[model samples]
Target: MYGEGDNQVKALDEVSLSVNQGEFVLIVGSSGSGKSTLLNMIGLLDRPTNGTIKIDGVNTTTLNDDKISAFRNTKLGFIFQFSNLLTDLTVLENVLLPRQIGGTTKTANKDATDLLKAVGLESQINKRANKISGGQAQRAAIARGLVNKPSIVLADEPTGNLDSVTSETIVQLMKSMAKRLGQTFVIVTHDRQHFGEVDKVITIKDGKAFEGEDDPSTASGKEMEVVA
Candidate 1:
């Protein structure tokens, strides 16, 4: 709801959904749809006006501001449409930023290194974020998102600015991470070609959510796997 009385606008109405642990879920909708809004809520960037949000069986809607911040730092990961890497930081440093803020930098160093390597950006770890290619930068962002060993990663249009090949690469990387680490992923994307790789797709239309079925004819490419 955006306003009061006659001006009220309900972005989402009676929407309820859930994702199983380690599941790769996609949320698809058009622009101006409530997909982004739903992502924000799940990522703890915004709170719902009504209804409870439970993460890992804990009710997050009841947490205070300080506790919510703590939960976000320790339990959730976020990837946005843009990489949003800090311009002044090196790739490794950007990936380390979250841990530094959470006061776990010293212990999480090796984990950060492994994550960057997993994303194929290990060689570019020392480069300034601005010096990296767009795909490389996005990979760094992925590393940052995983550094905390979060249970769930919430990505909002992570591939929106990339080429088809790069988008496939990014999605594959996320899928690989989920399988290897048993981490859950909830992504909002408009592309349908990658649907076959995910366990489920939830569609949002006019503020309502429905179980989405992917047609085999609409799916493209073989499901990607991480190479050893």
Candidate 2:
């Protein structure tokens, strides 16, 4: 419900789903099928008007504004359609920005460097956002998202801006990291080719979610375990 009675939009209606620990889940839907709304609710970026969202057994709907923000930063990572890196900052600095904002220890510098290397952005660590290709910029964004050691990573159209090859690379990188770190990932993507690569696929249609190979009109969500 977004506005007053008559103007209200029912983005999600009694939508209930669960994502297990260390699972990579995909959510697929049409343009207006409430995919983004679902992500926003799970990511704690928007409050649900009806049901509760529990992350790691903690009900997020009960958290206050400040607490929610802190929880989101510490427990969840976000990747959007755009990389959203600060143009002025170097790639390495952008990856370290989250720690800076959270007043974290400087020791994370090594981990940040390691993440950059893992994303194949090691050589471009010192370059500004303008200096990198779109794919490289997005890889940097992935590194920045992981710097906080979030329990769950939520991505909305993470590969929407890239070519097929780069998009595949990004998803593969995320899958690798999820396995290595034992973290959960819930991503909203429209690319069907990436479907079979995941573990379980949850389809979103008309504000509802269905499991497995449900409908062709809906984007098939797949969840896959990261193989070491």
lDDT of each: 0.83, 0.83
Give a tens-digit lDDT track for model 2, residues 120-170: 988999999888999999999988999999999999999999999988888
Best candidate (score: TM-score): 2
TM accuracy, model 2: 0.92
**RMSD of candidate 2 to true structure, Å:** 4.1
- Highest lDDT scorer: 2
For every model shown, the clashing-pair count is: 0, 8
Q: Give lDDT tens digits, candidate 1, residues 108-218.
A: 778889999999987998999999999999999999999999989999889988999999898889888889999999999887685456787777766666666433234
